[model samples]
Target: MAMAMAKLWMYCLLVCLGMALNNVASAQGVNPFEPDGGRRREMVPAMFIFGDSLIDNGNNNDLPSFAKANYFPYGIDFNGGPTGRFSNGYTMVDEIAELLGLPLIPAYSEASGDQVLHGVNYASAAAGILDITGRNFVGRIPFDQQIQNFQTTLDQLADNLGAIEAAEALGKCIFFVGMGSNDYLNNYLMPNFPTRNQYDGQQYADLLVQKYNQQLRTLYNLGARKFVLAGLGRMGCIPSILAQSTAGSCSEEVNQLVLPFNANVKTMMNSLNANLPGARFIYVDIAHLFEDIVANARTYGFSVVNRGCCGIGRNRGQITCLPFQTPCENRDEYVFWDAFHPTEKVNIIMARKAFNGDPSIVYPINIQQLANL
Candidate 1:
């Protein structure tokens, strides 16, 4: 045990020294990791993703739930047709994986054997931060359950590569978490659920932030060192929320409800970065980015900002895109793909922004910078 502690200490010391040298090289406008030809290489060892349908690749297909999306028009543009991704093509994490020079991370439900070595996506449709948040969906994997799945993956990895080696590999990988949207969309805002009557918006945000802190700490304890926590996007402008509006406009009330949650999460991220040893945390200002895209829809080549490409009723959101439904001809010019999710184009833009955009949107540092560190 003493020998193991000494070895861990020596490894940490060397990592810190290397980071310091990298910072110096960065200040001199030179990237030590980059070759002369500027070819992109895998930035991190691997990327483990956790979130809801926004990033869920295929974790909900086998589950007996209403949130399943492994059918037509869902993965219409993907090379692998109808692979359970909520979007038409790639998700935000898929884009990030591509930008990182890594293949798309497979879903936890589908990942097997050596596939687990690269990474696994535990995000599920309708999953939320709180355990009870997604009960309406009946079979969704909440944040806690997702972590358990990751633990199972870790056990498999440990059997393949010894415990110490697995830990070392995980420490160098990226942990991307984009939860909490379902906590609001599927729980707090749902009339059948008593979340609204139980607590006001601010109190609910506080409760979520508290629980999220615990959940993230649990990951840190299990060898996750680098984290990218994506903040909730502009839910008010979503097709579903917009459909509820009498006038054809964004719902300010709904948008205001999510502000506290995003703000609290940012505070929690800063606290975690300060408190956790060897752990780094960054926040993605998803709301701001979404708003920017909506505000300048034309600039981003999006024409329809208030309706879905394949949904029905008002704003094409009252009923989500039905199975076998034909999507819009100009899929590239739409902001939303369904009532609750954005189009692949929008996902690509969001991923690009979070990957290398300015620090104002992706707080502290972007994904590329986080990978380098």
Candidate 2:
């Protein structure tokens, strides 16, 4: 009875807190849950994306890689249809671009000439911090290569707008980067790779941060000032990891493995902000944001959390969604779109939260505040 009463009190406390937050939103005349809530006109001049499949857009469409998603079912709900995006609809960055009052940032592979003036997305499927990270996927562009591609884009901008104007434009743009998941999913965890036999989890995290630090510095040198670094989400809770579980539960071991990486990256944020003058870095707490959505799945209108909306075997994760495969009718109710990615609804929620959420979700300041700065 005591335990039950304690639980009840905790529940009531959460309810009261939610009500208070809602009341604050009402008083301020800005509903955070709404899409247009805190949008104060166009925020950033442009947004340049660099990451893995989570925000790839269409960089892998023409690449001879197995990780490409330019087929049916992948973009069944999307207006363009299978534009190399892993999700059925929009990626998190796509939603973020819209929130910033800009059109979808074109992929680096496809954008040409003045098309990249607004910004360019160099994210690719199966890319990682390490250059040799995604060798299994023959044609995937690694993080270093992506940076080189951005340099090429910068040259193009310089040629078109002159060096001074290009520098000023890029300074006001947002650099949205979400990497490291492939380092864990494709390199560290894969049996085919020898990453695990290499350094242990802590050592690996250090190596990644060490390399990532230099890479970010390169981007800073190239004129990127406002940086939004999205940390790894709960990879162990995804359908691919859960499918490997006999008990059909999230892989706690896998979760613990990546914790150090996120912590180190968070610590690195303060270092970058302090050391790199004119460079403002903000860390997005993807792990916590994903956890809250899963924990409160019902409240968020999600019914299926452990399995993918479209896949083959146990938890529908043995194989990723195939071409022409029909997905769940209720896409909004399903959290996982494939064995490894989230649905469009989930993307919208995450983008919104990171854009305007409190300090707990996005440290130092959220995306909106960072843009204004």
Candidate 3:
């Protein structure tokens, strides 16, 4: 035990020293790796994450959800093996946290003590904004429930730091939401659900946005101020959808379904920022970024953008990446990691763009600017 403690101390010291050296290097001049600043900096004290498998990290590991990704092959390219991130390595939030000069946020299920100070990730695999969205997955926490979990985290924070300090800390933190994929994949588009028969694509989007509005307002009331809401990516381009396509191309019909959701969210964001005092919301154009990547694959070093890196059946997307499955060797050159998730390489690209891009990709203000504000 004493030896382990000594080793831990040494490791922490080395990490701290490396960070100090990185800051020194940045202070001298610009580094391409650090986009927000030359010198390393912490833009926000904490960053609270929400949503589904896209940014899940490891929150669903203990849950009974089939969406969990803690087994082998899932994290083949990450820090050794699986840390519950859907990506091969880091998720978008992981890269975003690094950009913020903060350590990776702990899963809400595992966080304790000072861990909450940095923030907590409440995202779960197969979870969605609607309570019934991922019901097929059994134990996945929905967005509303994720928020409720966060509220519990807040209560714990208040317990540790007192109410005033906790509230102040929360008000200044960045709130990130990246969801809605499962709602389309597992609920609306699924033949088992009556969603398609009951409502058209645009009307479904409105329903989602309305519930989303209430969810975001709830977060606002809970002291969240800065927000980064990632618009849905082109669902039709995913490996799962491509596998279902007879032409082995992106399904324009499925793609059209998501367009209205992203559009309405932008309008909702504008309204939210305008009405909520001190609230600053940044809308990230994920579909735009992804479409560009697919269109210009060679420019981005991707040789295969339609199929996933791992899975079974057509496009390796009929099923999610399976356990012990030998993932593709050239993971960096692929866009999708599995049926429903992007490779870590792509995740980094998305995070970086959302962190610093202009209005073309991120509207109003980018994450870096929002963090600075």
Candidate 4:
């Protein structure tokens, strides 16, 4: 009887040790932005993306909006056809899908034709964190309306995956939100909007942060736990802004606006994380990363960084970089794909920086580190 009791005690001890080890492994493996590294965890089986043209694959093509990219040259390099992405080929979203071992997520507009699977993109070009950004543009989907579309997409997913499964999917899935560039470029800086006089740079930035927090909280309430929040890129250095300055240099005026804006966003993320439980918000600093690549092109194996390859003139603004426009023979030399967007090679570099946990490029914490959280 004594020996049997001793064996039972030993077995219990072994079970306890096993449980502790498993817990450590699980904690170490948890990735908020992506699935666990090895032997993919089936937890987040989908990714629901929302934002602006940076992520908008083809949503605006169907929508009655002036901010449309569902035509030639937009997707010219993507499968030799227009996929509505404002790039020569795949976007950051497409790369994320590839990394997650998932199929390309269809646009929310095209969700009708698909098998109702993993994910859909609801990003619209010229959309902003604030509803007014779209309204100011006159005929674009507002951020609030975009969220409504997200709700519709979720409803359909729930119908297919069942309510509980849909909720689980959303809770575990990665939510990629990339926006705010248009808010600065189109709405606030356009000089016609009352917002320009109503709010100074700091005040405007604060307003945007508030809007972001409210929208994020809404998504959180809707069962979103994992979020990949991409901050605004360097607006001052874009080809268009350079052309506006006419100095053949980046616009300090625009940079001044963006600097405080990014700072406020960082502060907001911190406050949100503190307030919300189990909230994994990873801020991808696209500005700093792009700046580094542009400033030190040789370090990253690029030949040119100041001007775009596709467009003409010193500022890449002789004309809009359409299909008929003459493209530089070597695309790898330029940092920008067009007057406004980065080249595919640049996006790939940014994605690598995001995945590798570059502290400077990814503020607070990297996406991979956030996943561990």
Q: How many residue pairs clash in each candidate?
A: 0, 0, 1, 2
lDDT of 3 by residue, 1-373 (tens): 9999999999999999999998776665432222232343466768999989999988889988778899888888787689888888989999999998778889998998767777899999888888889788888999999999999988887876678877876776889998888889989988888888999999999999999999999999999999999999999989999999777888999999999999999999999999999999999999999988989889999999989999888898898888888999999999999998999989999999999999999999899999888
Could you give candidate 4's per-residue lDDT for residues 1-373 as a string of tens digits?
9999999999999999999888766754432323222434423466788888877888878666767666666665678567778776778878776666567888887876343355778888888877778555456666787789888877866676578866765776778888788888778888776788999999999888888889989989888888888888888888877777656788888988978778887888888888888777888898888878878898877886666666776678544476656567677677877777877778777876776656777766765555444
Candidate 1 per-residue lDDT over residues 285-325, each given as its tens digit: 99989989988999999999889999999999999999999
The per-model lDDT (C-alpha) reads: 0.90, 0.89, 0.88, 0.75
In candidate 4, residue 68 scores what lDDT? 67
Residue 203, candidate 2: Cα error in Å is: 0.5
Off by over 4 Å in 4: 1-43, 113-116, 134-137, 312-314, 369-373
Candidate 4 lDDT at 47 equals 76
**Per-residue lDDT tens digits of candidate 2, residues 98-186?**
98877788999999875775589999999999988888898899999999999998898787667887787688889999999999999
Better of 2 and 3 by TM-score: 3
Q: Predictions ranked by TM-score, top down?
A: 3, 1, 2, 4
Candidate 3 Cα misplacement greater than 4 A, ranges:
1-41
Worst 10 residues of 1 by lDDT: 30-39
Q: What would the C-alpha RMSD of candidate 2 be, to one decimal place?
A: 12.0
- Candidate 1 scores a C-alpha RMSD against the true structure in Å of 11.5
